[model samples]
Target: MKTRQALFLVWAACTALANHGAWAQNNPVLLADVKAPRVLMVEEATGTVLLSRKPDEPFAPGSIAKMMTVETVLDALSRSEISLDTTYPVTEFAWRTGGAPSRTTTMFAALRSNITVRDLLSGVIVQNANDGCIVLAEGLAGSEPAFVTRMNERANTLGLSGSRFGNSTGLPPAESSMTAIDMVRLARHMRTAYPQVLPLYTQADFEWNRIRQRNKNPLLGTIAGVDGFAAGFAEGAGFSLMATAMRGDTRLYLAMSGLASEKERQDEAARLLEWGFNGFTSLTVYGAGNVVGQAVVYGGAAEKVALAPREDVRVYAPTGDLGRLSAQVVYRGPIRAPINRDQEVGRIRIMIGDAVLQEAPVYTSEAVGEGGLASRAKDAVWSLLFSWL
Candidate 1:
């Protein structure tokens, strides 16, 4: 088994290199020409940005802020703070602030109507219903302002430095802003950490109060493999989209803000996703549990310990390869003994040219016990001999 695994690893490495050579002959267009003022496309497995434009510049996110609403509610559900079946009273604040008379987009929840968390999620995510968000906010956190505070806390926890939430619906008060990159990160985290809610994003239409309205996501059903997320538009924010799609094993995320119109938003998002799928192919350099390399150990029974990735090590190769990709095994060296098997000790940094795309944590493959006197002396001798050489 060990021999076959070793042979497979060697063969995989060689095959990847040969494919790199073949790909170099074809020059693929860079995404600099993509016209969206702010856009980002990230390959999920490797955290590789196939394309990005002003990703960090904050702008009005419109309803894309609802993704955070979906995420936060799902988290509350998981913690048993709420349940799919739990119902909340539709407060006047929810109705008057975001409901029909306000002339804002809504799920049409009647004043003081009791609604389930599940139904509200569908309304907010699928319909981008502002009333649904306010209701959930008021129900879960007592008020929209308190819920907005939680959203910011969650955003900060997610490392979304360029994002702030002014309301559950991402309405503008000048304080709510998010960069394309931050939106992408938020979407990716939600998809990965809370996959159950993703299907709600794809629902074609939601019905409430006997009024059925179709989902506003332009890419839904139109774009192959496209799953739904959220879209937003405010008078000042223009149109924004945070959408994701999966084909085969690869999932790609896109976030764009300030699109001139709905048509432009759809066109730019589709073009970007198409470019991503066509512009990059991924390479699995190390499978989970496969020993990537070895690390020197001190005071251990073994002089060196096998290092394996905590998860699979995948790297994105541009559709038409520039050259063979490279990576480096990085860790604090000469790991001291009493190391347990499966202990995290280091990481594998996947690289494209001088840039690092992904870092997969590496771990010890077996326990390293404290060495006996004889073994210690032998290691000491080996170190001395290697130093002399």
Candidate 2:
């Protein structure tokens, strides 16, 4: 499907297509031929590791290092420390240093030329301009080394334990390295907290001084629902991609680092995306105010109270997995009377593995009205109300 978002990803529906053998068996195993040891596919919302292969192991980040670059730039822009309209004077060094050495990312670059910060950002992101990356980095932090420090600092703040930054645009003589899990973590962070920055990854094309540059991501227009994210390749790093797709509330994010070939990476990523959706589901069995279960009452007018699957419990487990899912309700100590029907009497814990996926609130089923004088008197005398109700 063609999207107004610059046709960054597309799916080949060509006739006589291959029947993607994507379903990782129940005892899923990575292809024996797979060279990359790390791969991770996670559901962004819940952090469910759907499929993984040594995902925590660190590897070359390749141009994907630019992921951090884009993030730092977005942070500065969002904080108003800088503006897209702010212009930077392209010095001789900025021209000769960025991009693939001798090649500039944007057209506004010529000795002594001036380009706005917005233009430079577009170069770094939309055009994958090395020059733009250095300029934006220097513009914000006064030098690439300072900017690199800021990037690492941000990475630490985000809990990217396996990630580090050496340069703004990932290039040869790499000193930076990150794990696939860490890359997925970065993608998840961007997708959840900084979505406005997400569009930069899908920029199909960019223009500078009458020059046009197309995004290097081949999946943008070819894959359905593929929006923002990035792709990277280098002899040392092979090809890597961190991408997401939105199929309604069910959005899937996948990351593969250290692939042996471009085709393998895309094929594997697309396969994982398709499998995640086809084999899993999002079931919101409960909504706020929806009575889910009944809980026993104590010293109350009603014999029992209602419990709910509080906070809308949604799961991404395999189909039919919801049927086996279970919950445990909890609330503070001995129950009291006069409870509001909407009161959060307890919480529901949903579990699949050992982990408690989520906790939803459960409320009293009915208003536990105060007992009558006789009932109170009975409670005071025989203490049966607390036992009977």
Candidate 3:
């Protein structure tokens, strides 16, 4: 009979120090010179976004969609549905469209030749081989269209909501697209989920059918700690990149699009990544199992239930700017009882000024059962009294 109260609890205890270790007395780096129209940088360890600009705007993924193709194949390999040694034939259509005849990036796979998945993956990752992508797609799913269906399904499964695939090659006329943040998420997932496959991205070149081509990613060796990923360009999308770099204990993931030129893409990506590495410090706001707040429970034995994060709640704060940091625990209450222990009930948002830096899910620390009729009636009256507030 009572209306549920939506709770918004400000977590005053969430305070961070302005100066951290080596970053003392330093101001956060500004990204004014970076020319990309869409960009995002994330701290991989804390899952904190360090910087962003129009991260959700969709753009053609270009050859970067090959990352998803790689992910799909890795998923199949994990399920034992295929293996690196599995061979796929280079069909006439594949050779004509993406191979020697197409004059696009290719491994120059001979038509009707059987190539192992391992070599095809190398060709795709190291050389951005369009023909290799087609052969693998056709071999695995009987056709590229069927394979694209799987790519979209996998994107949904991975929470890449802003991504869609019409082809495995990411070439034009395929209708594939992704947002900057989505590409960063996909890059993060690939690194975490497929560690064994990462070396292929870093491989300098792949030699197939007596022809060798080097990896096209510009950031690979030019930046210290830069490891793997891809870069691409479309007619209207300009240039784009999905990159990851590591410096000792910290790692950063980046995605950017709509740059003016290849040189601009490389320079902007390097500058942004360097800024991410130097500008932020990790701030632990709440330790694991520390009760962050309480939410009112209706018709429960207990009046309120404690909430906490499953893991340590950490955020990346800009150097020398802790004054902008704040946090809040948000939940819809009075939560109806019989609540299960460890059930996810809400989220804690870490903010920097008006922008949300990161969010972590909060859960009920303990179970609460339905209360007796007398307690329910009391709760009903209490809810009614406060409902107007």
Candidate 4:
């Protein structure tokens, strides 16, 4: 089985290479003329923006709007609010909705047609099916409009902060808008939280009879280790994408919008990914429950108590920048009686220069017991008799 799996991987890689060559040749040659709209490459493990060009500015996003749909769907699946194998009856309205030129795409929404939720998701992600998206949205949320509302709500929950959604398929002329930074956040969520659903982005081809269709995402074939993402183009949105690639422990994600052609998008993505992977390193700051120092405890048998961290925290930074950082444990103590293990008794503020990186919790390692009546009386007498001393 291992041998067969290895052979399959080799075959897939070779196929991607050959197809990438063809794709490279077929790429539009005009992108060099445009000023190059904007590009942002981000690292997932670290909230590092390796490259930023108007990363915070909003762009039309074209079919990249479908990212909201993907996110919403995956979130629902993760929440156990829906099942993958459940089937939906495709409505005629879904069939009529227009989208990418891929026949393998079907949202399983046609009158008298039934499709499993898994098929609809695969179609939307792999094929960028317009109709499939509409059907899935309608079936899941009772209507497309309602589904979009959920998408926006999820965006806020994600702290996306700057993105807005108006359609599920993202085949706008819709009000959909997303910034490169926001899109990177979406990509991070997809990459980290829904690892199983990622394959839909790497799918090169899909078949629904004679209408075999292919994914238009250029990064899959051109960039080594690039996989899982969507690409879209419209007259207003131009060409845009959310792309990811992995090399060793370092992974790169880039969001490009308003590009001239598919080829340029791929090249730009590669450039950013290359720079990011070659330019950075991530380090572990400290382990969970690490005993940085003994905390002062009063009214207990011991004058100081164990001071352990509540959680593990790490930092991802450019090499040589690690030592400039320092940590301080802060608390309001003389901690009265009664303490618990692993409690959020204090916080350790990690700082690099003036920027606060992460402030993790510090626990009360041991409970502080109350002073007994006799002990309290003795302490009072000693304090009164020798107050001046």
Whole-model lDDT values for every prediction: 0.79, 0.68, 0.87, 0.67
Looking at model 4, which ten-residue stretch has the lowest summed lDDT?
Answer: 3-12
Best by lDDT: 3
TM-score, model 3 to reference: 0.86
Model 3: per-residue lDDT, tens digit, 1-389? 84666766646456444334345554555667558888888898888887788988999989999999999999999999999999999999999989999999999999999999999999999999999999999999999999999999999999999899999999978789999889988888888898999999889888999997888778988998889899988989999999999998889998889988998888888778877877777778788888988988889999899999999888876866666677788887779999999999899988877788888999999999999999999988888888888
Cα lDDT tens digits, model 4, 1-389, are 01011100000011111222221111222334333476776666645554567778887787788878877877888888888987776666676664223343343344557777888777777767777778778888998999999999999999888788888876655788888888888888777798888888888876542356677576777778888687877676578888888888777787888878877776766766665665455655667766755554434455566666666655554444454556666766544444566666666666657666556667777665656766445544544564453
Ten residues in a row with the worst lDDT in model 2?
1-10
- Models 1 onward score TM values of 0.79, 0.72, 0.86, 0.67
Question: Can you write out model 1's per-residue Cα lDDT over 1-389, one digit (the tens) per residue?
Answer: 01011111111122234545665343454556666778888888788877778999988887787888888898899899989999988888888877887687889899988999999988887777889999999899988889989988988988999988888987655368889998888888887789787778888898999999998788999888898687888676688888889999988988887778999888888777876777777887677888767887766888888888877777776756536466677776567677899998777776667777677788899999989988777666665655433
| Model 1 regions more than 4 Å off | 1-16, 23-29, 235-237, 288-311, 330-346, 362-389
lDDT of 3 at 29: 52
Off by over 4 Å in 3: 1-4, 15-33, 294-307, 333-346, 363-384
Clashes of each: 1, 19, 1, 5
lDDT of 1 at 313: 79
